[model samples]
Target: MSGAYLEMRNITKTFYGVKALDDVNLSIKKNEIHALVGENGAGKSTLMNILSGVYPYGTYSGKIILDGQECIFKDIKDSERHGIAIIHQELALIPYLSIAENIFLGNEQASKGIIDWNKTILKADKILEKVGLREASDILVTNISVGKQQLVEIAKALAKEAKLIIFDEPTAALNEEESDNLLNLLLTLQESGVTSILISHKLNEVENVADSITILRDGKTIETLEKDVDDISEGRIIKGMVGRDIVDRYPKRDIDIGDIVFEVKDWTVCHPLQDDREIIKNVSFNLRRGEILGFAGLMGAGRTELAMSIFGKSYGSNISGHIYKAGKEIHLNNTTEAINNGIAYLTEDRKNYGLILINDIKDNITLTKLDKVAKKNIIDHNKEYVVAEEYRKKMNIKSSSVNQTVASLSGGNQQKVVLSKWIFAQPDILILDEPTRGIDVGAKYEIYTIMNKLVAEGKSIILISSELPELLGMCDRIYILNEGEIIEEVDRSRATQEYIMGCIMEHSKEGKK
Candidate 1:
């Protein structure tokens, strides 16, 4: 703790009688990677938010000492001006803008109200090169992959000349390749004297990069371990985060693969906007009635697009696909038809596309199939409440009441609500797109258990996941997609990390030719 760059003493924050951070004290050395590890509600983000001025000076009780001086930030701009830049889990990129434009968006390189495009691009190029994204500065933000978007976010911080950069789950959406690139960039930044405070759930990544680790639980500081600590294993980190040893990170479930229940054939989907560009090319697969069929792919490999295109052509146009349910052909021209034909897609993006944040849990749960709770176009509040309560209990949605707004819940609870909404629709074929993205380990285990139960109940599931481990752990069979095509289909017993990645690399190389 000698010559620490930042220190928080007796930090305390509360919201509506709930303590977010209680007398938390932490210190970070200059040009060091400090990891903040905790469960979803463990107040890690709250503390970081306070430090970054999201909670502001008066809202939270804390004394933030930066570089041996007292600091009080009233807003985000104040924090940025103090060389503290935070890249949130949810990115704030404008899709229509170019990468250079987004990088220097608010703080443009301008003189007398005139933007210097040449200087802006040049500066953006320097930052992008620093982040190992030299070729992406000219591309539109929408044209890039999610992983590249994250690097762009870092570039934005670099353009601001930020010293104490905070990354909140920066690698949550990135694939292995992209995640490695970002981590290596962080290391490079550290070598060049950039201090980073990383908030992440991936303990392996944390252990790999962090110079020190701080664990928080129940709004209290648990312990801090230096990089040289002999007992700083992932298990120890999890114990500190959850306050208990997770005997099995993934729950035990007996696999029971039954007969085929859902099947797709000759599926070829073109890009929704560009007619000549194909996103899902002639992909064919089958899902057993009592099995989880995992779709594994790298980013931009068409996993989510294929699922969305199949779940009522939501992703692509000029689509030529045939879907069958229980050995009978079905037509799903829209989401309503897909639902009516016993197919439901739980979107990967819960906040933007899945849940109505302004609505209460009761309203969101019954949104998809309101016909069941309506009489002569008049809604039955009692029935809707009953339905919401049943699904809430079934999914273990942690909410005070059904009347609680969806926005107020944590990430894990919001995910549960999204699942509940689809589950109450009584779909026989459930297409789950990254269902466990950005949730905690405890909540992930619960979701895995829920999937097991659903399969046991003779419901077929199509799980699309970027994390290969998740697909390998949960699916009975996996389709390794690459460039909108099914390159390899392997049974769970046969699929390996090496095999999946090898297939993708091969496919990508062939596509290049």
Candidate 2:
């Protein structure tokens, strides 16, 4: 309160009579990178939404003080007018629009009611250059990589001359290199006199970049730590966020790996759009019964491509692969075929591909296999409700009821619903792609425990993740993939982050030759 740039005092919000944020207080200094850390549903996003004016002044009770001036933001535009901006996890740019147009979409550079194309492109180019993006302003946003698109979002925020920018899960979709680059850009922006509020589950990034950190649990503030004045270790932040010390980040499980139960042989997939470009190059791997076999690779290394193509030909065209279950060859031409053959693939981008966000939890849970809750070829709503209710309890999904819309749940709860749907399908082999991405530490542990339970029941899993530590800790064996090829394999005891990175770097360098 002394001289903070922004002060949110006694902020409170409720949904359907349930408190989402209660008497939350946050103080962010000028030109500083402040981090908001919390478990899922801990009111971090809610508070940001209010600050960004997604929740209007009348909806939430609060005192928003900006530089000693009290203010009320009626909407997003109002907040933007006050030099506050928010870049959501999912970029808001239009796919078909050019980068320049998307940057100045609402806040356009115009003369006499007409958009000045030349001015727009020039301004956008400068902003993009400031953010260290090399792409041309006229290029379509969809044509660029996801990392570049993230930079475009920052440029958009800068276009409004945002003094305080909020990033919600900014690096959730980025790989290690891209994440590092973004963090560096944040530091550069700090030097240029812009304050940033980063909401992320990645504690390492918080520990590295944040000047101050605030921890929220449930709907209230737990504590705030100043990096220079307090012990701001990741463990300390995690303890505050979860309200307890987590001795083990990854739960240790006994390895009881059995014989190979699922196999993919000579899998080759060409790019779906570019017929001559190969995406997967004769990748061969196997998953043993009761084993968690991991695929570790950098972004665009074809791990997701291999998993999707084997699961159902979901990712590539002109796919050639041999998949075997119990030594018997299985031809899976579509997702239905894969599911019927006891295989399920959980997509990495769950918000876009997995659950129907508009649907209720009950509907989403039984969507995979309606026959289980059907009679005489007709879906029994009562039976489906009972089945969904049981899984909700089993999965420990947090919601008001099974009738609650999946969109209303937090990221972690939505993931649980996706798992529930697949678990209800009773697939023997589950291919999880970036399963723990964008979720908090507590939710991650719960999912890890569930994975162990699945393997103990003799089910096999193919884990494709960018996190080498997760792979080393959970998988029985790890495969290093680089540029669509399996470069090396390491057993659990032999796996190390440095070794995996070395393998990828070696193969990548040779490929460039």
Candidate 3:
């Protein structure tokens, strides 16, 4: 085998007595898709941070050798100067800025003490075409779809002439089509001799694309396997990462469905932006107490939009719906009214709509229900701490302290914080949208337990998920949504992958009919 293009040796990092990285080592080949697999807090990000200069040379005990020579990165700029670019999990792009401006924000094509707009646009356009993002350079970052934004990020890296691009959960939020496009793009980049280090929890994608895979567990390197290795299955990778064979990644749960507690009738919601379009066309469903009602749909099938519209018209321009909680009509025109009327929505995009990143866990937990921890507009710090502390333990949030910044926590913990905030509101009906989207298997099991516990307490849950297995595993009843309509509802006893897929096809046929 050829010598690694980049190698990290004896990487040891600590944070207040916690060994974040315990003598970890890694090697990556040139022009190869190298995958780094690990559970959350297993030092994947930390190791990447060290390499990308998020933790500068002096801060961590490690020797980074690139192209057979020692390298010392004092800052992100120093690393970027050496052609190392990192596309973070949460994308960093100016929403209001045009794609050209965002792509060439720092690396402008300026001349003679003046900003050259034409040259900048021209350079951005060239890089955009290189990344297969043609004709999108003039569109505002906000106007483009998320898939395109991701490509723009790649274009930005290409603009910097990035030799080594590190994607930290690049496809975590992307749908199947977008993710496929990105993987294909990565392959194209590889063929063009650009090395990539991908950190992801999606094992299927890793197994499909990665030339080699390295497993990290509890901040220590386990082992690295080549793509053609004899035992490079998903189970093998999971074992290496977790140090044990997980016979079943999706935990088993018994379904005990009961009486209907929530129902929506003729739920017609207009598109939030396009006034002429109707997102939910006369959708209707019933959710039982002590049962999980899964809303299954493909991307853009109006599942999320339906949940948002039902949860106090959070996203519809023109809405007409009738909701009954515990068999009684309720008025929930806004989020406040919805919360007061025993409804809570845990958004799929947690960072944007769910948690305040800069705020501590305590502050975030009390955000939804400040009155419970406040006396006449005065927040009781002790009470707030007590409440946050309780949920942190209850939800098994792995954080240094409740005082720790929410931004500093892992994706799983951030999701828990979001759940804690909503649970504190004590809603009778809870809507969970892709709760386990980017989390690891262990974290997902914890969330599933939490869901079971919620149902045990007699609260109704509406789970909106893209993963069919999750819906089949957790929900007592599943509703198949297709193109802004409820095509079919299958009970837990009768639901199958084939039936669900058929429902999707049935809806398509009806639309064509």
Leading candidate by lDDT: 2
**CA lDDT, candidate 2, residue 486:** 91
Q: Give a tens-digit lDDT track for model 2, residues 1-513.
A: 136999999999998678999999999988899999999989899999999999999999979999889989999999999999999998898989999998998889999999999999999999999999998999999999899999999999999999999999999989999999999999999999999999999999999999999999998988889988999998898889888899998888777888989998998999999978999999888889999999999998999998888878888898987889999999999999999999999999888999999999999999999988999989999999999999899988988889999988889989999999999999999999999999999999999999999999999999999888889878999998988999898998888999999998888888889
Pull out the clashing pairs in model 2. Answer: none
Candidate 3 Cα deviation (angstroms), residue 411: 0.7
Model 3 clash pairs are none
How many Å off is the CA of 513 in candidate 1?
4.6
Query: Considering lDDT, which of the candidate structures 1 and 2 is the better prediction for this target?
Result: 2
Tens-digit per-residue lDDT, 218-283, candidate 1 = 789999999886577898888888878888866777777778888899999998879889888888
Which residue window of length 10 is worst by lDDT in model 3? 248-257
Candidate 3 local lDDT, residue 239: 84
Instruction: Write the number of the candidate with greater TM-score, choosing between 1 and 2.
Output: 2
lDDT tens digits, residue span 35-109, model 3: 999888788999999999999998889899998989999999889998899998888899999999999878877
Report lDDT (CA) for all predictions.
0.88, 0.92, 0.89
Model 3: lDDT of residue 322: 89
Model 1 residue 301 CA deviation in Å = 1.6
Which ranges in model 1 have alpha carbons more than 4 Å from their true place? 136-138
